[model samples]
Target: MKKVRKILCCVFATVLMLSACVDEEIPNRNTPLGNFEALWQLMDQHYCFFDYKQKELGIDWNEIHDRYYKRITPYMNNEQLFEVLCAMLGELKDGHVNLGASFNYGRNWSFWEDYPENYHDSIARSYLGHDYYIASSLKYKILDDNVGYVRVESFSDAIGDGNISDMLTKLAICRGLIIDVRNNGGGQLTYAHKLASHFTNEKQHVGYVYHKTGKGHNDFSPMKSEYIEPAKGVRWQKKVVILTNRKCYSATNDFVKCMHTFPNVTLMGDKTGGGSGMPFTQEIPNGWSVRFSAVVFLDKDYQQIEFGIEPDITVMMNKADVLKGKDTLIEKARDFFKD
Candidate 1:
């Protein structure tokens, strides 16, 4: 029920499809001012976070336009103008936003960079050892303590109910479950939704999604409530802990949001990397493509999660534990189950 596809990917695909049709003449994307105007207008009309950013980040679209517009001149080189345009887009502090060129790509990745990295690959690998079960992108095993450990790196790969049910049956006897999704930059929303469905046997309210309706920053369609129907396959019955970090963004963030609503599900670790905006793609006059968030996804109550979500239990990885090749979060979760 919660959104499965990231907004940007959906919109970008649609825009690419429409652009493929020969109904409209291709816009002149050769001049600096033309590209600048096109990018500026694209964000001005379709970018969904302006209103929220204005209140939260103190961004004024008009002022940003005025500043970036001055940098764009007919005589300016593409490299120089691209730098200015990228800078203009960077103020949003969004990871889903990017400007692509043949030689370079411009993006705002401060979402994860500005936060503490709570995951260590070596440490996690040590826990998985040499014989971990692989179910698509899901790496799982029953820990020595009889705790179910499942590490999901990304949701890009497709998985079915049969696979999920088989995994659940394998770990069925565990006292508890730990789902580690740290550093997962996200993939498909469907995977997130499907994985979350197993934790509940009833329909669960997840969040809301709204699309831009008009050019106005606040012009949006009515918010729609999203639900996650319970899985038809085997579901977990015991306490479950979802591990998170700043790198758990996009679909992973949505998965965390849905899991937070399940009874006995505890979200542990650092804040999530949020990318709740649906993105749309447009091109500049120079053939450079600009992608931005065009759809807004809200929490069940209509609150914004564009930045990220806080975990229920804020646990940072212990450095002393890492030296021992242990994930502090997983160990802590094991203790929780034993208790």
Candidate 2:
């Protein structure tokens, strides 16, 4: 019986060796880039929102999906995948179409993970509330000219109202108010309303959020201003100036949208980073958190303003201007009011 068992083991070992020699190689299925195409399709179909620009890309969505996806897939790292995805999405010139891993397998990450840091240059530091400000917090300052200035890094409600009120009060005392949304990645819409209420004494409709429903878009206009704020009764009611750049996004963009409704509001600097929607996050089985556009924003005119809000006063920053410690945009704004 022992000899027979030994013979059977020898025969099995020989067969396994032969099979191994002839076996086909299986591709690395877990490459982050390999999943790019699948990821995009999943996002398009299952994404909480649909962007009209997807159709406007001049390429078929499926074709665009297949081509760029094939180019990006095969990278084994998530960071690499993210880099490629960011580049690809930049083509759309819209901020609403964002990507993230689903939160299922314990992957908990915030959308502001890559939000720009507020270095708070000395001039900025003199005025902003630091300890309370998170990495995404907006920078509030009282400029040298008492032209109350607030550098909104992000549109987060987590930022204390005291900080917002403090600087807004300064702006109220100033000749004109300058709300800088440049490089602000955007956050909660409630914060947008909260910030806007400082400039608006009356209950005004800021913007409307729209989502894809059935065959058309679903409009979710947050017209019911939750005006629990009184601007601390420090009114900067004369002329309000908003400093916008390409990086001013999401709720910040919505804030600009609402500000546009007022005739006294003047937007200076570059065009805003256009994203006019509320984000909804979902968790996937892999513990990854994925965020999708859950809403779209439209102004009182019923225009679904997405690719970002265009500034009324277009100004660009020059390196020389920066070296001189001069904020050309702010200077331009101050000059505008002075004139």
Candidate 3:
């Protein structure tokens, strides 16, 4: 755990230093055109996925600037400028890209909004019942079939190692474990790594990360290998099923990526809502902050995970099952343990 912590710290520090060093000079003007130029230049120089998005979503950043530039008028109000800027950022179709202002948060959620949501809170709660044990943000209980069920709603809160160790110890008697991260929209990356560390027995190379090096869209540092060391405490060795949905994003997306590397772990349900890029924020001339993906993370196969990860066994929520007061994904996971 200490080694993993150290490595993560180093990675983050390096990214921060690199970002500081390559800082571009944008004029600090409060006019609408001035703010627009600053925001566009900021994203043009720092945003990591321009090339990938160009290929995947046909997003030409240069062309976007010209098109949105025409929409920005010197006489426009703050709200109108905000709308135009938000629309420009939306061209990338990235969930991590957001424009934060005092009045509103501008974002693109097409990543999950366009897909089938394979989760239901009411049905999921029914599976946990009213007697589930709460360990920090984790809700867990043993099922009638001797299977263990763990529900992780979000990673917004930090979870202690002791909490995880005790949870695993309690579920040790179960034949298999179901870790449902269905609507987890992500929080701390460390928590995602912490939970995934308990599933592996050895240090494993999970992926690679690339941080920007210069002002160019393609100016990325050489891909650096990322590894996950096994947890020092109690670990789950039996079959583990990870239930995912379109709402699984950011750190949750990272958790799914890490868990995908374990041989005993199976990803089930809809594809994850990918926000694989590490986000960094810079203030525009208008006092509004612009947050964009500054670092890129790729899987071990060197494939881009910024869009999302496909499940090994794709399972959609069954309307029939929901009508009967059951979660299809949980039922599927339980049935998998029986096999």
Candidate 4:
């Protein structure tokens, strides 16, 4: 299976947790520099990239210390110094980017709770129907005549088998599949790629990522190419209708990038919320972990979709249509299969 070239929401939040601290004492002014130094050293020592050496960034510790001293010598506290550090790091412009900060970390679905109005409103059914069954405990399903609709709620779940198994069973009888990912955010890019493989029978390269070298003007180099191959024992030899909205982000966006390689895929509904990139995280002292983007992704056609990815067939829901129980998005996809 190939990578989807997008990260998941949990992975992003987990990246933040890597640099986060909680229920801990604040460090002294001398400690911030030490913390930053330790973090930099740690990343150089353990980072997964092929080139994680300081020489790659063209900076020595002595020079970095001098630069920091000249820039923030007037600051009175570690907090102020840390702010400068954050600004310096943001220059990486990569996914999984972060700074050491206080954060609450746990295994709860906080995204849904924080944005209940977005998921529970009338749009939920249009995206994920109220009666949709979670078949195989992974993929979701709903019937729209000959078209079978499935809404992948998330990529990885601690309690379920995930979407791949569910999709295998449900897609067998349908003329076409409507994969709704309006607010999926993201999960594991590997899973996103695996799920996308079922829809594509031929081998194809999905996309590529370019990481920042941290040198001020150095151009990024290619990482590895993600690709897709056919899935054995679970073949969906039918048209794939992907339903997206502005909230479909990260690994979900990668799902879209991979689907474009196939001839059977068609995108419908609203544009996808684009947060496509490769993420990385490092643990700092005092249980604080910071994460950030280490790379940027380009689609197979070499387009960088950062803000959003538009639908092949655009459709938006209106208030009147909602009141009348008319799901224009689903109707549009259903009409496609009917034709």
Candidate 5:
């Protein structure tokens, strides 16, 4: 019986070796249908919001494929093909999703389209005036009412420990602080997270992040808790008013999320442009780079923030106020800060 088992094992090993030596034909990646399949499979497997989107946005992935497949043809040009793919991706309505090529790129900006432009660079500059202090990338000045007004146009710029220390130290005597982030399109989340950390005294749970683990859309790893540890630098001790608007997105949106966890922080202005997904990029067979939200994040209570977060006070810039070169949101924040 042992001799027979040894003979059978040898026969199996021989067959496996012969199978391994055979060459397999790779799929054609240059064809239109081929590129389509690559992009489709990439999103189908890795997009983080499939399950959530189907439930909330009623996105039928299979149906989208069937509808868009007709647009692909063997004779279509690259531009024509790219347009079709962009149109297909537009259905997601997620700003984190994008397709980039050497010629042009695709994105969805309806998050702020048709919404009020609640922030103006000219107005912010007026508030800062000639003597406004500059600490690294931060622009700050004291309001007439003894409130500190800090306008952070974008998180794209980096801020350091010394920068925060200097800004906070100068504004320490103010009754309250206004962190205005309107029209801030967002960039590095590290800056936003680090900035938000200064408002809290202890470790804070801001949200949870989940990533894909399999090809199935529903397959996801367990949600990982996200925390913002208190900063080692100067922490603001006074009340805080975070001014936001429809233009605040990406890391800025996340900044608002983190601030929501703090008791001293109050959001005043328009709803944020929601873009909670953590983006991941890939290149298709045609060399075009495609990006999608590969991770899902929920608020501290496990709520979806993909649409956006609302401010405690929904303040808008009144036409009269704007004509007079005054920002209503800033004025409202100043009133809230009055002691």
Candidate 6:
């Protein structure tokens, strides 16, 4: 695990160095047109997924610039300018891209918002009952049929390696384990890696990551292979099911990607809400800051996960199951263990 961490750190350091070498010289002016030009130029130079998005979504960045440029008026108010800028950023169709201001944090959330939310917190909590044990942000309990259930609400908080080792130890007696990360919006990447490490007994190649090396839309650093080393502590030897939904995003998306590589781990439920891009923040001419995806992460097959990963078993929430206070995905995972 430490070796993996060091390698990832070096990769990030390389990205930082490469970013510093670029000459991004947008003028620092407060006017609407000036801010618009600054934001457009900044995204043009830094955003990493232009080529991918162009092919996938038919987004011609140059055409986008021409279309949005006409909307910028000298007499436009800050709100109007914000709307236009937000709309322009929306063209990328990325949840990682955002425009931050005092009044709002503009984002494109169609990744999850447009899909059927297959998760119900009430139903999930009912499965946990009132006696679940809490280890940091992990809420876990043994179900009636001896299936261990762990609900990870978010990765925003740090989940130490020790916490995970202990949690797994307590649930070690179960026939199988279910890791449910339904609505996790994501937090630190290290936390995601930490939880995923326990599932694999051997060091495994998980994916590749690369950052922009030049201002050109297609310019990028050579892909760096990402690996996940086996956890130094207790590892789950039994069949493990990871339940996901459209609400699972960012670091959680990365977690699903890693677990998909493990032989014992089966991904069940809806596809994850993908935000595979590593975002970087830069200030425009105005005081507001713009956040855009600067680094790209791909799965072990070198395929894009930015559009979400498909589960090994696709399960949807049934209205009848919901009415009975049962989580359809959780029940499906439990049935999987039985089979």
lDDT of 6 by residue, 48-74 (tens): 999899999999989999999999999
Against the true structure, candidate 6 has what lDDT? 0.93
Q: How accurate is candidate 2 locally (lDDT)?
A: 0.60
TM-score of each: 0.90, 0.66, 0.92, 0.65, 0.91, 0.92
* Clashing residue pairs, backbone N/CA/C < 3 A, model 5: none
In candidate 4, what are the lDDT values of residues 1-339, reduced to their tens digit? 134334566687789988865653323224556565665555443333323324344545445555654555543465665666665554333233456566432122222233312222465455455656665325466575867777676665432224465655765788888887767878888777777777766788887777665543244565668678777546677888887776677788888878877888898877776666566666666456766445676687777765457788887765575677766677778889988
Best-to-worst order by lDDT is: 6, 3, 5, 1, 4, 2
Query: Which is the winner by TM-score between candidate 1 and candidate 3?
Result: 3
lDDT of 2 at 261: 75
Over the stretch 257-300, how does candidate 5's per-residue lDDT look in tens digits? 99988999999999999888889998788888999998787889
Q: Please give the CA lDDT of all the candidate structures.
A: 0.88, 0.60, 0.92, 0.63, 0.89, 0.93
Cα lDDT for residue 154, candidate 4: 69
User: Where is model 5 poorest over a 10-residue stretch in terms of lDDT?
Assistant: 19-28
- The prediction achieving the highest lDDT against the true structure is 6
**CA lDDT, candidate 6, residue 46:** 98
Better of 4 and 5 by TM-score: 5
Show the lowest summed lDDT stretch of 10 residues, model 4: 105-114
List candidate 6 stretches off by more than 4 Å: 1-24
Clashes of each: 9, 23, 0, 20, 0, 0
Q: Which stretches of candidate 3 lie over 4 Å from their true place?
A: 1-24
> At residue 152, what lDDT does model 4 achieve?
75
Query: Alpha carbon lDDT of residue 222, candidate 4?
Result: 54
**Which residue pairs come into collision in candidate 1?**
1-227, 4-189, 7-278, 7-279, 8-278, 8-279, 29-285, 29-286, 30-285
Q: Please state the error at residue 186 of candidate 5 in Å.
A: 1.8
**Per-residue lDDT over 1-339 for candidate 1, one digit per residue giving the tens place of the 0 to 100 score:** 236567777888999988865663435767887788788888888899998999999999999999888888889876888788899999989988899998789999999998779999988887888898988888999989899999999999997888889899999999899999999999888988999999998999989998999989999999888999999999888999999999998888899988988888998899999999867898777788889988888888777888899998889999898888778887887888888
